[model samples]
Target: MTDHKEAITILGKTIHLGESKELSFEVAKLHTFNSVEVPVFIERAKKPGPTILLTAGIHGDEVNGVEIVRQIIEKGINKPKRGTIICIPVLNVFGFINLSREFPDGRDLNRVFPGTLKGSLASRVAYKLIQEIVQEVDFVMDFHTGGSGRFNAPQIRIIKGSKTLDQLATKFGAPFVLYSKNLNKSFRNTCHKLGKPILLFEGGKSFHIDNNVTIHGVNGIKRVLHSLGMLATKFKISTPKTDCVFINESKWIRAKYSGMFKATTPIGSFVTKGDFIGNITDPYGKFNHFVKADNTGYIINVNELPIVYQGDALFHISKELL
Candidate 1:
């Protein structure tokens, strides 16, 4: 018997082998009565393989991942060798326009997954994503960044379990690989329940693009595609000089007192317990207090904003594998 014709439908458009299409999923209506749509990009290869999804901007202000996806599409690097490649550069169109992390209803989009049809605006957006885009893929890569004033080192985070996902994270080749438990109602947890492997890449800072992080992200994605046999070309992937640091535990270094803070160590700095990470000083330059690391680890995220309050997360430290 001849091979069955391969076809996949998204946003009501059927894409056959070796075809690429752009479609929009209407998410909501603006105050001006205009439709807000989530743009989707799809590429299918003539040969059969695994379908993978790349999603970014769920937090809206995470611009590095958005730029990385845009560059991949603009540079024509998204052509798949086999199977399909689905890209959703911006999932929260409303939050993106407002430069906010939450929807107009003040709900965090990423916190409400597998949402409902008759729910609130955030829930409805999440529902559409799960029903339309997420259900169509076998694997997913969700890109994110440190919130607001924080900057993150390039890293890949995978929930515990799934050898396949671990291998994929290693292939992505980020400097750090974090194994953690999934959050309730988050995309990772939702996809895991559906038997799908999802890898989350956190890098840079919100609202601005970090070229270094963006380049690293693009290269890592290409390597992943190649490893999955989805890249159109047979090029050797470049391996990083240092192996990825695998960490199972991490903690947030919170400020003990509110003040104007200055960080002494940058993101990606290796630190020992009791190391002075930064110092907090009163606005008038009186009464200075230092913050020290409670555990030996690498700084994966650092708060960039000078102003701080007591108990604010100033640094995120992940234990380094020895």
Candidate 2:
């Protein structure tokens, strides 16, 4: 639904048609009574159209996600042609400030969606987001990266079997389209429950910014907005160099021995059965294990950690394709 009316209210501020405003959502104060706010950027075109929300940095350490959204705002790509564009680059400001993946209370913001006002600090922030922000948008594109120590290939993740989501993911044109179910209590799940269409973009790793990852993310955003007829005229949308591989099922390749590890095979590369993907060896060089692929598939995520114990996940390989 398009907000074609006079003005839209957000965070207690009334923003009229075609107005650009920077609003802040204040949730807490620091120990010294310093107020913290999560900045929200809004851009609206005079013409009536759909509103799309671009968000990232749910985990404070996911700087890659924050950078992707920042570039969108800095380059003026968020200036829409016929609708509204909302950007919230850093959602977990507290965790971001502390350089952590969770709130000061040790709660992961991503796991507390549609939070309660009187719950933990993370829950309060989540509640504020869903109440003051998410409800105002028609569509959403949330950016993310692999967990610490794992570098993910550029991919668009959505639940399988929704033709609308399928079409949107195709338009996004990332290197991979992963069919992942929404996690319980996650923001994706909360938004889906509210009937909002969301496309989760994952790339790079936490606290690391890769040029390739940022490029893919920005380009994918452009393409998706272009498909929605929301991208501005000055912006150019290009076809993705390769057709995104649609993965229906996947599994992780774990370490067999506790030791130093390194991956010889690059991420996003296809490997057949028994291919030399990586190796594990003791620091004293007393043992060496050359890890091999268990089946034919593409490598979507590679654990970049230098040391791993036995059974630690190393590579995420595709198993079934659509």
Best by TM-score: 2
Q: What does the lDDT come to for candidate 1?
A: 0.86
User: Per the 3 Å backbone cut-off, how many clashing residue pairs does candidate 2 have?
Assistant: 0
Give the alpha carbon lDDT tens digit for every residue of 108-208 in model 1.
98888878999999999888888877777788888999986989999999977678888988999999998888999898889998888888999999988
Query: Which 10-residue window in model 1 sums to the lowest lDDT?
Result: 1-10
Model 1 CA deviation exceeding 4 Å by range = 1-5, 234-236, 320-322
Model 1, residue pairs in steric clash = none
Worst 10 residues of 2 by lDDT: 1-10
